[model samples]
Target: MNDVYVVGVGMTPFGKHPDRSAADLAAEAILGALDDAGLRTVDIEAAWVGHVYQGMAMGQRGLGAAGISGLPITNVENACSSGSTAIYEAATALKAGAYDIVLALGVELLSTKFRGALAPDESDIEAQIGLTMPSVYAMRARRHMEQYGTTPRMLAAIASKNKFNASLNPLAQFKKPVTVDEVMAGRLIAEPLHLHECAPVSDGAAAVILVSGKKLSQLGSSRAIRLVASALRSGKLEVGLPDMTVEDLTWRTAEAAYQQAGLGPDDVQMAEVHDCFSIAEATRIEGLKLYPLGEYPARVERGEAGLGGRLPVNMSGGLLGKGHPLGATGVAQVIEIVKQLRGEAKDRQVPGAKVGLAHCRGGKARGVEGTACTVNILTI
Candidate 1:
């Protein structure tokens, strides 16, 4: 087995891209990564592309637009974890000596796909009952409040923090920071959840070029970031009414990743967890054990999770401020971690970041805790 390293990372601005085709966005990201890696298309041994609503042959179409073809290209779709799952597949192949150099890309043209709040598949019972993502998270928020004494203001504070971080990010969708009061005053989406707390619909793409240890030695690039672990897990069926305030799936996935990386939550210097909603961030970090259960809200309020604090989370502005383009999200998270590790994140950079984790959880099904979850650990 070969050790895998990411040589380059790239992401398009995450926001409305109604004028761009999915292939175009993917190609831009792919080329940007190639340029960053100082490599050419011919250097890629194979490619994997993750997307949800881009239909069939997305891998072929995206790579074709990037002037890459005649190689094995696998298309992946695992809901919101689609992009991260693509990275997981690529890493597995590299570790198994299947490829010396591979490209993993995630793209979505969500602006032209849907409008308003997103829901589960219509066939799902929850979707049929008109339960949306906002409503589901709202219920979790309410429960956390009841159980942990969290407040609506605390959730707004989370939003304010991410948006402020986004202001420092050039590619973030929402550049201007909003106050906690602004977040609180925003139109209510569901009970206890305002529009500002929800991740907006976005269209974007991101890409990373990974190489084996031998290939890295051949390239002699000093910018390579080692990928220590890439772990994925699917949610299990609920036996009974489970605790909504906790995320068993996230904990299990992070445990697997930490084990594979030979590290623990204490070693993680920074993180980019799935923040589809304000409440999601609080629950995810808790599940990852980055913060104690029922203590993240207070920690966040104390500036512990912000940049230059104890442990910065979502320095890329997260989905709340960075925009959630479904397929692109997971890959984008990895890109942020890569940048922070490389000391290239400028204003939002976490000081002396070494070990960073990226988490992505997606989808919902009837009677299941979650659909798909992925955690990737990287180190400089």
Candidate 2:
């Protein structure tokens, strides 16, 4: 297999834009990525797109708008991790030497229909039983509290910290800094989660270009960050795992990625994690084994996730600040990490960041794409 490297990355702000469709937003991201790569439309060889609930043929529609068509543009729907899954596909194809230049795009334009879209509507019993995303996450939060003594305040602190980070981001949906008290007082969306703790309905897209190390000459002597590892796994049953904590899928995938990279969490200088919600970030920090299990929430409360803190997480403000554009979020994270590696993030940059890690997962605590997840490590 060949080595893969990210050549360019780009993103659109994550938020509500009732006027925009998923296709147009995605095209803008593609253009931005292409421009960043200093390439033209014909430079891309293949592409993969990730999205969900955007209606049929959405991938083709979005790609066509980007001025690339008929190049094996496959659409992936892996729930919230949709964007990350797409990135893994692009990197895998490049690593396998099937393509030198592959583009991955993640886009979503959410409407009210997105709320109930997860139900088993004309599909399964879960949907018929009214199993919505919020409730599923709420259950996880509740369980975490029961088993680990996690609390609403801890969850709120996560939200508040992310919101504060979001304030540094110009594109985020909610830019104002929030406090734990405010999050606690916020409207309750489900059992233990206040509405503020929930990821709001957002629409946006992100794009990235992956090139084989052999193709680095195309960029003409610019310092290159190589893709050290990319691993993806779907969730499976694993008893005894506490709620919202590390899952077997991400753990296993990270193990493979770490093996491939010949590095561990300690090698990662910074991370662009999947913070679908505040608590999600806290749990993922443990799930990814970035820290000991159950310690991430407390660290965040101590201002450990800030820009210059121990691990400087979600520097692009993450999904919380960057806005969760569903399918596009994973790629956006990649974009931010690339900037970190290149020292181009300016104000939002992680200082002297050398090795970076990015992870994405979709859907529930378990099941299919919901359980599906990917972890990638990159370095210059």
Candidate 3:
């Protein structure tokens, strides 16, 4: 099988884009990625677009807006993992030689879709029981506090850290850093989760150009970042209640990615995790084995997960500070990794970052750990 490499990455500034349609945002990102790759519309061999709550034919509409037509276009939706799943499919196709060059775009216009906390489908048992994303995460935060003695202050610190990182990210939604105390004082969304600790309703898009090893050699692109691994897994039905503090889906998916890359957590220099909520960062990093279970709060306290720390995480500000435009989220995480690997993340750059991991977990279903989870590893 051929290896896959990312030749270019692009993203719209993640925030409220009331004036933009999803197609327009996607077109902007697509154009930016094409320009970054030093390629044109005609060079793309195939495409996949990810979205949710946007009617139909999102892939065709977005690509057509970018002047791409007469090529295969697939639309994917796996909740928040939708965009990352598109990348996984594109990479798999490249490895199988089904396509030499592929484009993966993730776009969402949530500002016009929903007003408040996002929830699972109405048919979901959890949703029927009045469980919104915030409440679910709040329950997890409560569990962590009960099980690990994780304090509310620590959770607030995570939000502060991510927002501070966002302050350095020009494209991030939350440009100003919030103090931990300020975070603690913000209006409560759920028990331990404050408004500042939750990901905002964002509207944006991100796109990436993937090329097979053969195509990369043909193009001789010096900016290429090798995609060493892309692993995706769906949540399994739980036979019994499981620990909310741990993420089995994330662990399983990340383990597959690590094996594929022939590397372990210790080798990961930095990461962009699905910090949909403040507690999510702790749970996900532990699930990926990037940090010891139940110790992440302390790690954050020591600044071990900050930009200059031992293992910087969410340098893009993550879903929390960067904004969570579901479909755009996963691809945006990969873009951040690509930037850090290419030495192009500027102010939020992790120094000498050679290997990076991007984790995205999405959706909740009845009697399942999670609906979908994806782990992607990249190397410079």
Q: What is the C-alpha lDDT of each candidate?
A: 0.94, 0.79, 0.94
Question: What local lDDT score does residue 329 receive in model 2, on the 0 to 100 scale?
Answer: 80
Report how far off residue 106 is in candidate 2 (Å): 0.7
Q: What lDDT is obtained when candidate 3 is compared to the true structure?
A: 0.94
TM-score, per-candidate, Cα-based: 0.99, 0.93, 0.99
- Superposition TM-score, candidate 3 onto the true structure: 0.99
Question: Model 2 off-target regions past 4 Å?
Answer: 115-122, 221-223, 238-246, 365-369
**Count of backbone collisions in candidate 2:** 8
Task: Write the residue-wise lDDT of candidate 2 on 39-111 in tens digits.
Answer: 8878888888888778787778887998888788878888777888888888888888899988999989885
Clash totals in order: 0, 8, 0
Worst 10 residues of 2 by lDDT: 112-121
Show the lowest summed lDDT stretch of 10 residues, model 1: 362-371
